[model samples]
Target: MRHRHAAAGPRRPRLPLRYLLPSVLLVVVVVMLLLRGYVHSEFLADHRVRPPAPTGTVPEKVLSGGPVLDARGETPVSHRVPDHKIVLTFDDGPDPEWTPKILDKLAQHRAHAVFFVTGTMTARYPELVRRMVEEGHEVGLHTFNHPDLSYQSSARVQRELAQSQLALAGAAGVHTSLFRPPYSSTADALDDRSWPVAREVARRGYITTFIDTDSEDWARPGVDEIVRRAMPERPGQGAVVLMHDSGGDRSQTVAALDRMLPELRAQGYEFPRLTEALGAPGPHSAVHGTDLWKARAFVAAVGVSESAMGVLVVALAVVGVLVVARFALMLLLSAVHARRVRRRRRGRGRDGRRPQVTEPVTVLVPAYNERECITATVRSLAASDHPIEVIVVDDGSTDGTADLVEALGLPGVRVLRQPNAGKAAALNNGLRHASCDLVVMMDGDTVFEPSTVRELVQPFADPDVGAVAGNAKVGNRRRLIGAWQHIEYVMGFNLDRRMYDVLRCMPTIPGAVGAFRREALWRAGGMSDDTLAEDTDVTMALHRHGWRVVYAERARAWTEAPETVKQLWSQRYRWSYGTMQAIWKHRRAVLERGPSGRFGRVGLPLVTLFTVFAPLLAPLIDVFFVYGLVFGPTLRTAAAWCGVLAVQAVCAAYAFRLDRERLTPLLTLPLQQLLYRQLMYVVLMQSWITALTGGRLRWQKLRRTGLLGSAPGALSGSGAEAREPHGLYGPGEAREPRTKSAVG
Candidate 1:
């Protein structure tokens, strides 16, 4: 045995070098693969999941009435708006190729129909959606994809619903309380998950669709039958007739719509979305059917058909690229603006010295339902170091804002209690009462530093400067939410103000602390009530009249931010929607009104990109990134994505670095990259939708007092904290504080 073993060892000593080399190479390759997988999994895990309820809606009490809906809350309703007045609903589209033809036909016959489109579909054809809105067609949602609601998880169903909701909002400029589930199915099986989904949606204030009739065009019916099915002989009240626009060969359906839309209009059927129906009283007063059946049909039909996911993916990518490019251009513009400022300063030389002041200053504080913060704000104003006269315009605040202001026992702080006109009206009233040469408008919730008035007025020393925008600092930032707002204020609003200064085409002089020449404001006809963004409206007005708006970075105002996400959402929604209204109202200047119209060529475009396209693209990129990581070839994309992400992270970090105290919230920045950022996109899209539909801009008040009383992990309105000052300069120490109260 020993001899045999020795012989075998001798034989092995003659082994080939090739075998040894191959063995070593194979081991190295395996090790590298393992390392790669580990890195990917770790990074993916880090960047994929959202933190515990960092962003969410406040659980509002259900608006009483309407049957409770299912998981995919497509409730059935019996409200018929009359068979002859059949409203044609084309869902899942606004297809560019087909929808335009449909629109032309409808326009030719002076007809209108409701389009309940999928997010995927609308995104692919934003122009078509815009056309629908421009042509006066109602746009609703048919879910993001055509996923069967009955079989999907509640989370999946909600995501789907949100997809369409966001798409219609982002693409078509419409917000509807109505939604239709895929395949006309509802998740109403009394499942534990389904009920919550339904409840959550209803709590968010959406009315579930209840289709009273179906055209069955999705079933490949002949054009004649489709037309016949859609055209009810006596179109009943609240009837939502359904048909498809994008799924497969809808030419026949389109043709059918072309022929039948005019006929139906001739019959006196008013085509209104389920949204309009929800606003008005319907046939059923919220209780004619069982919950399950009610969820199944809600006197509406969402014409849904599937589109290839690829199209949406590509469209989203294109939109995203455009947004990113626009952002880059904006940054460049900011840089250019800074250079121009430098050049102008050098050119002016000794004339840059501050001039002696002879102008009277009137500070207008518009008060809404802000009783809690009104006294503090007014007191701060009274304590200002500058010579000032104060006027507090209470815009029908039921919270006794006027009473509190009147009782403040401060001179020169006169309270003007008016009926519930908008902020625009309040501003106009303030302007009329102002006897000062310089008018400073402030939000009632914001308090100013003593030197703020002086600094704000300094820019007005340059007669060319029509308005001066003061820097806004977060007044309450003790909690994480406040800290988050601190970052937002410093990074988003503050930085933009600086950039705007460089550009000399400032889009807005925030109401929190804005200074304008009394003559300039008067010349512009005060503030236009037609637009919601009064500050932006006046800014545009000044620009249109060949005036320059300057940003006063040194002039600072402190304001409280909404402590809850719901409050934040409501506030932001109003701001965004109002801004859009302002843009639309001033759209005429976008083209060549002349070289004097610098606003249309530069400022207006800047506003559009910053507010609209940036939001649109940011979310789309997030969606694409998620999909690529989840489904694409693994490990390879990691390097590329890391580079892109690195740039983004660096940019974001730099953006907030100016306010170091608030920079800590950047740690949560990565967390938002996972999901919360995407949610923001959804909210932005919804705001756009509501704007397009002419939804009321009336402020929806958020309950704020019980923030600290709630539990942290309660999944409700928890995570609330006590209000306190926070951000770059630390707590409670104002950089400047001034008081002056002079009655006119």
Candidate 2:
């Protein structure tokens, strides 16, 4: 029965904005992670490069004076720490590992120092920056990203300072006036290249601080050597010492600090913060109001990005393991299944010989608006070598599909007309009218070979066999889009079926070409309209009813594949959603007794993991592939991506060999992975969103070109079976019946 139709209303968009919100959020997270990686890799000074040769650009007094220079006025003035006092300034610091140890040593010796922190490190380890302020240590800006200021524009220099201050305000709620340029040493080392950078710092109201003592602790020198190099040459002569608490192993620096601080204090030397030794006012000013809150938000974003990156790495590892495991299992079990089939064909089964099945079969084709394909479909069934009764169920097609089939007047073919309901309802109607014990179902756009029916029913010779999945090929694979589907069908779908068959937990019998026992269909309540994938739904029902399902590789059918991306997306979105629907509808089978329990435990997990979760996480591989290429080490990144591609190519080649297919189509495998794979990922993700949100999906129909009837050899391995002519009979032409099969 059909439901009453309502008048058409205003058109609604296929995908609502709510359905796309989750994807947009995911993209935001990925972008944040990329930004974090770029900053971490590109910034933060690790080792110093030699400065350029000196030029006449530097002022003579500024170059020959002490380590600290005040250039904010017309004439630059330089100063050193007062006699009997030492100022310890650490660069590239706020390190989570070494900074705490150095601070603890300073506290024990009752000394205070200055930490010149890079903006990147401060943003990452905010607590360390805050502790510096609480412990009475001065914090000075070391610039953000640690770039060579001589090579940067005035605007870039300003941005670097402003960003550093932003991080400081966010972390410690303070702004500082003291600044240190990266890769700087004593004032005497200032060359033509670095002179302008100093002037720019002065224009920005910063007191440029340079170091007089060179510890060289960044090179991991011995602790004793570091302490010796850090000391002033003469007694009562003060100096500003340079050291590091971050970037590589800082154990030597930490150990050197413990020994040097107490010994210097015992010698009547005082270690004071940089400002204290200079007798100047404090450098830091507390932040307030909106500026403080904005800085806090920036810090919070960085923390979230770090946490998201950790989870993405774990997801990447899980996806890698799942992909490798799935490949290994498919290869091993498919070989076993093929070998077993060969042995049975050679009469080597446990019974020594197998029984043959030659009974007539009923083929049901449920079609809606498939007028262009019905003629070829009916003729294909009429040409089968084995006797078969063809029933074309036209489910309220606006086109003249039923009329066209009746006009053909082919022997042993009939047409049934009914109002539009859905595919599952149409299939159930066909099942009610089927006459033979063994029934085969196919789509209106699919064409079968002469031996397809005979080969499909052979598994029924075993009393326990209830359903058989057939090899469905793409018949319009001349285009690149079609070729991609061809590879997927041969490699992904068929190989998986072989593996599942060997495991005795076959999940789905494809609707394009599959045969079923009438008794099994009745036991499973025919087909239900509760899910879009009626075939998968009924197949699970049969498994739960303790019926055996298997695959028949030799039974081949050629079906037209979508040639455009829009059509393909529509088709796949339906499939992905429908599969989820079926999985959810039959989720309880896992805990049942008998065959239901076996399928629930084995088949359900495999389907959920490989079909759902793996694909959801698989996009991370490509995401990181692009990330590595953009960041650095291009050759290594390209090599790693090629390795993953090589694995997939090897598996695809083996699958093609098993299917007796030519390898010409494999030239596009790389492009398929780059482009086609992302489309699938998006489609699967959309399905996940729909399922989680409890959104409803309607049936979508794809337009057919009916190319299989005219060009049967579009794909490889069709053999001699596709040579029959496809011509409609004239109105007066009558074909004699080969078999007098009648419907009960």
**Model 2, residue 137: what's the lDDT?**
98
lDDT of 2 by residue, 241-320 (tens): 99998887998998898899888888889999888999899999999999999988887777777777888889999999
Error of 2 at 618 (Å): 0.8
Candidate 1: worst 10 consecutive residues by lDDT?
A: 1-10
| Best-performing candidate as measured by TM-score | 2
**Candidate 1: tens digits of C-alpha lDDT, residues 1-744:** 000111122232312332244335334433433323322232222222212221123122222222223223344232334333445577777676777877777777766677767765565566687787777676656666555454466676677666555555554444565555445421222233333544556555554553445777877778889877765535444455777777677778777776776666666655553434445532111222344243222111111111323444566667657646644654565556556545544665347545645466899987766665676677777767688999998877666679988887898888887876667788788888888889898877776766668778877767887888887777666666666676667767766776766666788888788999988888877887666567888888888877788876656777777777777776676677778878887787877565236778778887897777676556545544554566455465566566556655555565554333335667765555555555455556666656655455544443332112111111211122212332233345332321211110
The alpha-carbon lDDT assigned to residue 177 of candidate 1 equals: 59
Query: Candidate 2: misplaced stretches above 4 Å?
Result: 1-15, 43-50, 710-744
Per-candidate total of colliding backbone pairs: 46, 0
Scored by lDDT, the top model is 2
TM-score of 2: 0.93
